[model samples]
Target: AWCCGAGGGVKSAFPDLALWTAGQRVDEALSTGATVLSSACPFCKRNLSDGAGNRNVRVTDIVELVAQAMSGRRMGLT
Candidate 1:
């Protein structure tokens, strides 16, 4: 897992910057040939999800994915 750009006390004052940071991280993920990205923090998940909108990738909290798995729902963790 990696940063989602929602930390470092900047998200509250500079949401745009946080999104920009998340975009960078998401770009890195795209290069890895992965389609799914997961993080444990809610803030990270939110920022990452926002930055990754409609980018052929899925961002989610790992705990949610585990719950989905236990419920037999179709999901991924790439």
Candidate 2:
């Protein structure tokens, strides 16, 4: 799972800059040939997914993905 963008302070006040940062991350993810991108932080998830290319990559929370993989569910994990 990619940390996606710069995280924390970088994504708070400067969203456009954060998107650019996430774009760089997307390039790295594409190089890895990974379809799903997982992040622990909710803000990171939203920022990265929003900045990511259209349907080029799927973004999800790490806990949620694990639950899905295990055929289980997560509560209050958004």
- Residue-level lDDT tens digits of model 2 in 23-48: 87877887888677788888878887
Ten contiguous residues minimizing lDDT sum, candidate 1: 1-10
Give the alpha carbon lDDT tens digit for every residue of 38-78 in model 1: 88888888899888977989998899789988999978544
* Candidate 1 positional error at 58, Å: 0.7
lDDT against true structure, model 2 = 0.76
Give the clashing pairs for model 1.
none
Q: Flag regions of model 1 displaced more than 4 Å.
A: 71-78
Once model 2 is optimally superposed onto the true structure by TM-score, how far is the C-alpha of residue 37 displaced, in angstroms? 0.3
The C-alpha RMSD in Å for every predicted model, in order, reads 2.6, 5.0
State which candidate has the highest TM-score: 1
TM-score of 1: 0.81
